[model samples]
Target: MGYHFKFEKIMSVKEREKNEALSAYNDSVKRFEEVAEKLYELLKKKEDLESYQSMKLVSGLPVLEIRHHQQFIVNLQKSIEQYQKMVQNARNHMLFQQEKLMHKNIEVKKFVKMKEKGLHEFLEEVKHVEAKQMDDISIQHFVHRGS
Candidate 1:
């Protein structure tokens, strides 16, 4: 007899759900990396600007120009802060989605293992039946030969 799992459909649905959850988690990770890279680039720009401002100090630039540079630095800092938040939120979302994916994976694995175990038992039963039939046929052949 063919081995059949009663909950095979449910297992398949759970497998699909796991795949979707994994994709969502991967997207979240990508978004977090993008925001983090933007933040890192912004910080590097601020450092370079500071270096330029130090060079201007030796030449004694105008006060207005100094103020403008400082304002730009402040704006950059704010942008970095916002991007940091976005990265953090994305990280949190990735973690949540990962948890969901893990659960779905476990659910599907449980059913798959159960089905495998059932199939193993079914194959063993078939082997036993086949062996008994072989023995019965061999005994009948021997008895006819003796007669």
Candidate 2:
């Protein structure tokens, strides 16, 4: 009576999987961006600190103040190193998610193609059946007119 794809359920499942994969990819990208931003900020702060330290040196700041600046710069470098690692890990995770999403998209596309092909075949069959019915009706009318 109606066109029904045998793999409709499978297609729906694949589509759902694709959506989940897409969401995961988006989340991973967000995480990567956040970590990268933090790393960038840390680097910028370190540069600014170094510039300030140089200015202080030119201004003849005290030895103790120079040591304090050096200590703070060291701590900033450690933090920057940690953030760099975090950013790398996040980027790797994002790439992994992207690959998974690509696979899911391909799967969904395959199922969609199958559904389209099935629908096309079903429509063709319907057209053939309708043409046969029309031919039968025409034959019946012709015979009645002959009688």
Candidate 3:
């Protein structure tokens, strides 16, 4: 007879769960990266605007134009703050997903180890039975020859 693991179904279930967790983790990472990139772009734009505003000031730009620049800069700062919060939230979610994936991986490994141990025991039992049958045959052969 072939070796059969009693927890084969459970092992299969665990493997499926691991795959789902991995997919979720990947999605979280992607979202986090997108949010971070947006934050970087926002910071770069703010820097460029501040630099241009400084250059314009030295070139004797009108007071009205200066006010407009200041207003736009304030709006940009508010947006940057909101984006920063979004980035932080995304990072937290990614970390949570990573932790979940790790747990699923550990569970799958445990089931795999149990299956390996069970198979090893089954093989050992098969070997022991074969050896006993061989000894019985040898004794029978010797007795028949003597008779």
Clashes (backbone N, CA, C under 3 Å), per candidate, total 0, 0, 0
Q: What TM-score fits each model?
A: 0.91, 0.97, 0.93
Order of models, best lDDT first? 3, 2, 1
Could you give me the TM-score of model 1 versus the true structure?
0.91
Residue-by-residue lDDT tens digits, candidate 1, 1-147 = 577888889888988988998898889888888888998999999999999999998999899999999999999999989988888888898889889888888988898999999889889999999999999999999999999
Candidate 2 structure lDDT = 0.93
Residue pairs clashing in model 3 are none
Tens digits of lDDT, candidate 2, 1-147: 998889889989999999999999999999999999999999999999999989888979998998999999999999999999999999999999999999999998998888899999999999999999999999999999999
Off by over 4 Å in 2: none
Give Cα-based local distance difference scores for all models.
0.90, 0.93, 0.95
In terms of lDDT, the poorest run of 10 residues in model 2 is: 52-61
User: Which tens-of-lDDT digit does each residue in 24-124 have in candidate 3?
Assistant: 99999999999999999989999999999999889889989989989989999999999999999999999999999999999999998998999999999
Q: Please identify which of the two predictions, 2 or 3, would achieve the higher TM-score against the true structure.
A: 2
Ten contiguous residues with the weakest lDDT in model 3: 54-63
